[model samples]
Target: MTTYLPPEVQAGLDDARKRALKKSQRLSVQAGEETFRVLEAWDDGFALELAVADHLRGMVDLYDGPTLLSQCLIVASEEDGDQMRFEYKRMTEATGEQPVDFEKPENAPVALIGKG
Candidate 1:
């Protein structure tokens, strides 16, 4: 089954996804024992939302392939016009005061390819 999405945001999301898929930008986020996907990323932290039956606070690790990117606290948030997502609590040595723009073609994480 397919869900219908209106224009504007959907169009932009589709375009960004297409570009990201081509570059193989796969960001792996690890929290506790479960790992989630990064929908949006910044210098300090990344954003992710999963079917979490409950919310808890803990350290989250973001990785690009085998390399560790950021390790920080994650909290749950459900705001208006936003998905029930989790965000990094603070910035670490990986990310400085200035936020680095991700989701861009040049700065997006690279996806890993495997053989069948």
Candidate 2:
């Protein structure tokens, strides 16, 4: 059966959905001793803007779960009632291994001829 909701009812439903999304979709970032809930997140970093809080500056480290993401610098922060927006760039390269040490010699490859 095709049923239609009233315009008012539909609008209310949409508003509810939006709120639910915000409630569920949030991350956290460590700012000084306190951790602020991330209102929005991205590949580079997360964002938190509010009037009352310890000012975030310099390098802001973002994390996903317990894993730390690339460090980001506070490239931009506007003070509007302490309103600040930080745009960041990934600092560390994605390479799994640590930066190569030119001073260290390469280990000779071992042959496993007999062992499976």
Best by lDDT: 1
Off by over 4 Å in 1: 1-25, 43-45, 52-56, 79-82, 94-116
Give the backbone clash total of model 2. Answer: 0
Model 2: per-residue Cα lDDT over 1-116, one tens digit each = 86899999988986685456447654556656776656566565445655433367666556655666555666654443323456674455333567865756478555557766
1-116: candidate 1 lDDT, tens digit per residue: 87877898798996786456435557777777886656566554444443441354577777777777777787765432332455667745465456657545776667867898
TM-scores, one per candidate = 0.47, 0.51
Q: lDDT of candidate 2?
A: 0.58
Q: Give the Cα error of residue 28 in candidate 2, in Å.
A: 2.4
Residue range with the least summed lDDT across 10 consecutive positions in model 1: 45-54
lDDT of 1 at 53: 18
The best candidate by TM-score is 2
What overall lDDT goes with each candidate model? 0.61, 0.58
Query: How displaced is residue 48 in candidate 1, in Å?
Result: 2.1
